[model samples]
Target: MGKPTGFMEYKREKTKEQPPLERILNWNEYASRLSDESLQTQGARCMDCATPFCHMGIEVRGAAAGCPIQNVIPEWNDLVYKGKWQEALQRLHMTNNFPEFTGRVCPAPCEGSCTLGINEPSVAIKSIERSIIDKGFENNWIVPRIPSHRTGKKIAIVGSGPAGLAAADQLNQKGHSVTVYERADRPGGLLMYGIPNMKLEKEVVERRVNLLQQEGIDFVLNTEVGVDITGEQLKNEYDAVILCVGAQKQRALHIEGSESEGVHLAMDYLTGVTQSLLDSKFKDGKALNVKGKDVIVIGGGDTGADCVATAIRQEARSVYQFGKHPELPKVRTDETPWPQDPNVYKLDYAYEEVAAVKGRDPREYCIQTKKIVKDKNGRVKELHTIQMEKVLGEDGFYYFKELPGTEKIWPAQYVFVAIGFEGVENKIADHFGVNLVRNRIQASIKDFATNVPGVFVAGDARRGQSLVVWAIKEGRAVAASVEEFLTTSVKA
Candidate 1:
């Protein structure tokens, strides 16, 4: 819906990042916003495809194809192209409660399914979206919109991650009184600790949280729901309780010596570093110190990449990341056709940082860790690994075949496992009496009601580990269900 011919005239330009070597010196957001003019030009690259798949917001083959929150990509792109910055921001906020968060961290599946991306590079949707909201904040256009009237329906939301925050915001906007509970000292769950500051500054998260508080949502921090207040107590106190507790039960390495000292979960390492940075800038010596030590991160994906970046920032003597998947092709493959998120090889920010300093990418694909070797004092001393080849099996499935002769040992003092999470932690689910299916809270999407009446579940707790965008989508959906339940069933 942008300039009909603009897509042919202009090439896509991505948000610029500070040089890797320079940015690794500090834990601050390294990406720089493109100029307004450049963004408008990028926006013009949105083609007027008869069917704009960029906003389809569907899943194909278990992978997201477009904006899960159903952001009207073409409309906002047109507005931005026409220099209607405020209007673009309005369109962005209509679906996404936090464009800033998504803009900064979202992998942007929307761009993957862009019609123009079939042959050419996709429109800079993520950057344009980020610019619009950022401009709104800069020009004082975004403010807390206090609900005109209170419905007196109180909602207790457990977990302050993206899902919880989005649900809280939506429920508050719908005139329901909302209180969010976080076990951590801070309000933002994943945004606060799970992510490093270099990717998203804490102040950015705090800013949105402060606005939410001003909009009449209550945040009870450092209080675990099951430990501090039981689920039954919350159900009695509030009209409804929604669980947004993320899937944080990390999958562990089953290999020998996995329990050795100096081995840590990626989330633990990230949370500790962020907490220490916020608490005392690591002056208290509480943060994990990888300085001058050889570090190896096991597993791959965004979490593994984040571990690599954090290790680099900590001045590790050397860093290496291991992944079981083979390196992706440089271009989109038939296996992942258009309208599906492209599986292609591009250097992530973390890989770029490592390459800048080491003169080579630190990721070793198609490798599997066999064991963690411990030293005399029982700390991690080395890692044993073997190369693997992906083979198509007779059952029409692919399996990894280990190459026996390729076994090797690498020196390491720290081993961060970033294999990802299994599902929701059991304590909260058990305490709430919510039924779990495959470790995820069992709730139908039609109505996110758990087995317990008046209690609902959303986000990763219900859907398992997923993107922040998906979590926000669930949060919004569950809020609607809660609103209907409160109106139709609850007594004033």
Candidate 2:
């Protein structure tokens, strides 16, 4: 809207990234910020479309079509183009509590649904968003907003991930006392451990957590609610309890020899590496060492890509990632039309780094692991596999059909399963006496209220594993629900 013909005048230019060969040597974030002038030009590329689907925040065909948090994309783009950095940051925070986190790792479904993307490349919305938030921090524009008055009500939030943090921030700003419980040593649950530093630096997470603390939110770290503090105690101490303890039960590969030594879940491997890196920079020898070992990662997703990047940084001898599904098409398919999150192929950061060093992409599509062949000592030595073909059945659903006589074996000392999470851990939910539906906490999206009184659920715990932006949305929604509940209960 800032420049009507700007989309036609300027081509989309993304932020610069460190060369894969150079960045793989260290764990720092590889992407560099675009200059202010360049970001302004990119912002100007936002088309003044009447029907802007960029912030619709709806799911199309089970995939996110736009920003889940409903970020005001056009307004911020206009603000940035007009050199109103502070205003842009304010508009950004109006929807997203953690733009830095989502900006770095969210996959950017908003871009897939961008109006300009139907014809040309989408405006660099994500890059401009990161620039606005980063500038806000750099210029000291963001500060603690301590509540002037207390609502005389206490709320306890279980988990310190994005959802929990967002809920705590919202509730605290509304003058309610909030305490966030975290089982980990640090405040950020997934952002601190599950993600590698090269993608989302821990310092960024810590900076926000510190700000929340200054805003009168209490953080209780290294304490599990169900174990250290019982549900009854929480119910008695706090006016209400909100559960944001993400879906963390990793799905296990049930093939033979999967229980062998040197075979691990992807999240476990990532958490160990990140913890060790922070504790002693890996000098503690706590991290799983893949140095000089041929590594194989099963499951073709972002977690698998993260494992590939981590192994490369640890100097693995060889690395390969397997995906049962075939590679995505270069262009959008019939199943994913315009405004849907495009199921397209592009080199991810990990694949790029591996390609630079290995002279080939490390991904093997349509490959499924048959079993893990182990040595006499019970350590994984070879990964057995077979190719697969996607075939449509008479039922009109596509399924993977294994190709006969295409079996192969590959040498591997370490095998990591990155097949994704199943649901919440269940232990905490059981203690809280919340109902469960298909592994998720039984809570309605309308109110985020559980069957039990004074207890509510949100985020992955209620909706299953999803994007950080979605989690934040649920967090904000649950906060409003809790506030209304508190107000009504007082009147009752």
Candidate 3:
């Protein structure tokens, strides 16, 4: 509520991005920050309505509608609108442990639910949030607040993603000795590897991890639970264990020639490229080379887009992406009215990059792959696909019906399946005797406690594939539950 009429005075101004052509040439973040003055103006647009839905961390249409962590949106916006940046940063950090990560990667559901969005463009809350945290870092306002006292209780976290990290941060604040175990050579889980470098640079991930280490959180990398160490060992050694292992098991394609040499999983391919970039800067060699080859990416979600962008950067001859769903409307429809997550079409960075370099958008809607054509040497050579139309079935649901005579083939030397994940891998949960329903650990959200006492779950491990914001929320909530469990046990 900085200005009563601020919404009328300022139009929403989005952060600028480097041109696709120039940005595609490098693996750096392309989005540019707005000037401090411009951001303040954007902050002014926060109507700060009496019933603000921006901070209502609740479910809408079976999905998160606002900030999952319930960030103090209006208060911070008012702080920024008046140039009280230090106060804004402090308020922002009160709930969110990692604003920097969400500010870059989150889809900003807060904007969709903004009061002004009913008629006008919503406030640029995400960009303003990014600016607040980035300024805090630039001014060295972010430092480890070491706990003044230590609790003898010890805890073990099974993953090092956002959920695990947030839990560690929160539990450490309670003076508990916390150690996070990551199976990968590095922590941050998908944040470090699943996401491409251009969207969220690895350096940013490293900086946060280093800060966590400096704050006295112990990290045990290259150590996986249920493999390197038994689940019984963890239960015997630590007072409590929290599992935050993310949903990483990628959905697989089951068409013919699926085992061809040139076909690969999207994460496996993306991970290899990133590891190579970090190790040798892609000079010596690459883990999976797509140079001069026609690349076809299946699944048209963000991961599919990342595959397209990565192939373009690898200098692929051409790229194509297939989506099983029909093309989304350019504007929000009645099916997804205002205040709901908009199901609209807008060019993402990778789509923009492909269109710029190839002179055409490489996406096809209502398409399904029929077969993966392979060369004589068993490498993927092309893809056969067919167009589909939605037909109402007797079950009262629309099903994709293949349109005959619409089959086509395209040259594709490399194929990457970018379909979404199924659920959490079962090994760790099984080892710990935790029940899993639908590949997610069976833990009550009310307490975040599993069937096994002293065992808990959070993030994708408990909720399936979800946004980073929700993961952080789950982490913080689980930390509180762990604290309560520890206190009750000590009293007994």
Candidate 4:
């Protein structure tokens, strides 16, 4: 425990963002760091509960209830509170491979389950975590641990996302050589591109990747398996293969006029913007510009928020985000009680920018895109939408019925569809002769073995779209299973 009565004495505080007007001019991270003294005070709030449900890592009704990676929350929190950050970093790495990413992006389920949260504001577990890793870097304490012994096995990890990276890290530490393959020019998977720059700086990703490289992990980039390299070649070369490819198949609008020029899928548009930034070119050459366009962002999850933020920075004349659900409550709602991810509302950075520039928040709740109206030249000119929403049934059962009699049109020169993703593309899975259950590649929780020998599945490719924490957890678990299979060699 950090401090005996720390929880009672302290109030929750968080990092602040730069002024919206100033932040919108470019793509740079906005959140300011909590000072060292403040962070220590926040860390002392950990109650050190007897049960510590925060790290139990259990599934409650098919949703994560605690930290998926079962992070040693109390131990690290206490260490940070005591200002022993080097030891804290050691404690953190025992479970998680990348606190930096999770620190930036994870929704922080651990805080929700915190004992302090039973009635009051929880300990700033996430902020404490971020500080620990930052200290690790500042002190140059993070270093590669080359395994002392060798299992004489090789593992090939497909996709360099968090899952794949986690798997490789664990397997390598267990004395097996691992290689990660990425299709993109640079690695990091979704972290490299799907997420915008203003939230997570690219330099943060590269610094960690450089560490991985120094650790002797081989990265083969600009290579697409099932295209550049055959699946059979991979099976013959490595003792085991793991797929951490995420769910990237973006869901589309079946509504009319979707095929028009300016109507683009969210991922496709995001990818283009990111790629252009990385490549330093746009359609006009030199500077990639979405400037002066009236952008309409569809869907209301984090991706939608990201799209809104990205467009604002690109100098869009106006931006509107259409969410099918009604506005979330300002406080936790009855439907989502304690320990569930709170559906409470706080304006994300993007929404804040939209408000600063446009005189109001850009979100239009309970609105569904009816159709995309196009100009004579086949470019999107406007969007037709319906203001309808789904509500729970009063009869104590599951219900999702749409409300009626709400439709309107808004001028939109560019449309970015930010609906969520489906499972990974099945072509490679089918090509490898692995069986898929439902949409994802099937593997029991006991072990990540796929239908084919020497093949395993983990992360979003196996579990469908999910959090990065879950991906890392699955990766570590799967790595152990693959290690056992190769080491035992039919011992059973």
The C-alpha RMSD of each candidate to the native structure, in angstroms, is: 0.8, 1.0, 1.3, 2.1
- Estimate the TM-score of every prediction: 0.99, 0.99, 0.98, 0.95
Q: Per-residue lDDT of 1-492 in model 1, one digit per residue for the tens?
A: 888899999998979899999999999999979998999899889998989899898999999999999999999999999999999988899999999999999999999999999999999999998889889999999998999999888999999999999999999999999999999999988989988898889998999999999999999998997788898899889999999999999999889999999999999999999999999989999999899999999988898899999999988999999999999999999999999999799899999999999889999999999999998899999999999999999999999999989999999999999998999998988888989999999999999999999889999989888898999999999999999999899455
Off by over 4 Å in 3: 490-492
lDDT of 4 by residue, 1-492 (tens): 888888888888877678999998777788757988998898889896788878877766667778999998999888888988888899998989999998888888888778788788888888888878877888889877777887768889999999999898888888888899998999899888888888888788888888888776889999898889988998989888998888887888778888988877887777777777767635535433569989998889999898899888888999998887778897777766767666578788889999999989999887778788899999898888766646657786654445566667899888888888877788878768888776788888789888899899999989899888999999899988988898777622
Model 2 alpha-carbon miss at residue 301, Å: 0.6
Count of clashes, each model: 0, 0, 0, 0
Cα lDDT tens digits, model 2, 1-492, are 657999999999968999998999999999879999999999999989998899999998789999998998999999999999999999999999989888888888999999999989998988998889999999999999999999989999999999999999999999999999998999998999988999999999999999999999999989997778998899889999999999999999999999999999999999999999999998999999899999999999999999999999999999999998888999888889989988799999999999999999999999989899999999999989999999999999999999999999999999999998999998887899999888899998999999989999999999998988899999999999999999988532
- Model 1 poorest 10 in a row by lDDT: 483-492
Show the colliding residue pairs in model 3.
none
User: By how many angstroms RMSD does model 1 differ from the true structure?
Assistant: 0.8
In candidate 4, position 89 carries an lDDT of 91
CA deviation > 4 Å runs, candidate 2: none
Taken over the whole model, the C-alpha lDDT of each candidate is 0.93, 0.93, 0.91, 0.84
**What TM-score does structure 4 among the candidates reach?**
0.95
- Relative to the unseen true structure, what is the Cα RMSD of model 4? 2.1
User: lDDT of model 3 at residue 155?
Assistant: 96
